[model samples]
Target: MNCEKIKGKVSIRTVLESFNLFPVKENGKTGFYFALDREEKVPSLSVDYINNKAFDFGTGKNYDIISIVQQINKTSVSDALKYLEKFNFQPQEIDQKEEVRSNAKYEIIQVKEVKHPALVQYLKYRNVCDQIHFVKEIHYQINGKKFFGIGFLNDSGGYEIRNKYTKICLGKKDVTLLKSGMDCQREVKIFEGFFDFLTYRNIQRGANEVSDYLVLNSTAMLFKAEELMKKYNIISLFLDNDSNGRLITDKLFNQYNAVRDCASIYTGFNDLNEWFCSSGRYCDY
Candidate 1:
């Protein structure tokens, strides 16, 4: 494809997301991204999805979606086009309609406070037995197959279902918010997954710290939670030890001055839950 064709076929938002340079959704077709060509404390790259173009004030440069990718990766035009080819860009209206239909495939059968034996064992194996109160025993059917898993509710009324053999989401995907009862500075803890939240609780047992919790369910969902999160005076992140987590933490740190990364506590493990499980077996079975 040529320049205009390449730009029109690829969504800049998708391209940036593929690079893990997530941008906040501004409105229908416009979103603000961090400077792709320079270091910035704020988002200076404005992307227009409808127009398939972007302009970065940090670098005083205007570009189409292809040029943005080319700039960030320092790749040639042909290579950048090759990278953009990985994403299937579609009009937002059509994509949303199809997404709703696709999301309808999963049926949530029942959700209640955790009480299932197998789920209890699964929590135990993850070293989060005491966290049963926060999660639900979820029974769901997908693609004509019935399955059960531990479910953590997200802000958009979706459930992040997780079990030993399966992981999926039902309904709209969003972040999970857990508010600590006691009052404190507007400090909030951010976790990549609900299991990490449970692990943090297990590790910080008896502390009874009053802090808000935000679980993105997936690192890609961090941008979805950024608006409400900006109110916090301090942001503590307990993400996994993966590259995606590191990139997100770095982004949050740069954007929010008070952001603190607590990943050091579980430096050797993949995530907080892994570290918690490695500590000891607190199984009830």
Candidate 2:
């Protein structure tokens, strides 16, 4: 069968399950699956069964059934099609309730200090326990199920929630800009995620230099930071060592003379947190 016929016959959920991948959370026709390319504590890949498509929030990439197969198998389109030929099944139609439930709202039940043992352990695992004061213990409910996570607040009052097995946003998505409160703070450090920011703080413990911080939260929100970024004299980036990170870094460099790619500190690893967790060594800067 051709690609279009195969896509029409197979569901995104079927392709994901063929690889032993399952959703950590689901609401009606939408399910949140773990990323196909990386190992993450929380699921960041949102799969739409009704549309037979998936979107990875972490990488900001959209995938259809064929692309999802290619990503998971690291194969070409032809190879992906050949591999998918084995899973010939009819697609199921989603009902109206499931479609409406896909837009179900999540309620923030409570937000408090990070005192839960599990959350504290998660911080220690990421080597950011010392930065606990920067995050909160968030209790939220989605689809009538209670859940909690370590939440990092953004400028728009939304929380970037992370836990041992969950990663989600509680409200509107936006970049988080933190000020140093210095008389003339010109230097600002940019991180792709809050963990990297925490890792930077953990690495810079006991340092006297004061600088502002901006966490993009997601690379898709990079444009939202442009106005705020203009105020800084020095912009050091601690983005991941991936294509998306490099692309954004290059974009900033071309746009602003103050931009600096600091991923060299963790040369061989994916990001700052990965480098610290693997080597337990601190950056000299």
Per-candidate Cα RMSD to the true structure, in Å, reads: 13.9, 12.0
Each model's backbone clash number: 0, 0
lDDT by residue (92-148, candidate 1, tens digit) is 212221111112356888888888888888888888888788888888875677889
Give candidate 2's total backbone clashes.
0
Steric clash pairs (candidate 2): none
Worst 10 residues of 1 by lDDT: 93-102
The model with the greatest lDDT is 2
Report the C-alpha displacement of residue 177, candidate 2, in angstroms.
0.6
Q: Any idea what lDDT model 2 has?
A: 0.77
TM-score of each: 0.64, 0.67
Question: For candidate 2, lDDT tens digit of each residue in 66-135?
Answer: 9986876679999888766554421121111210001225799999999988998899888888888899
Clashes of 1: 0
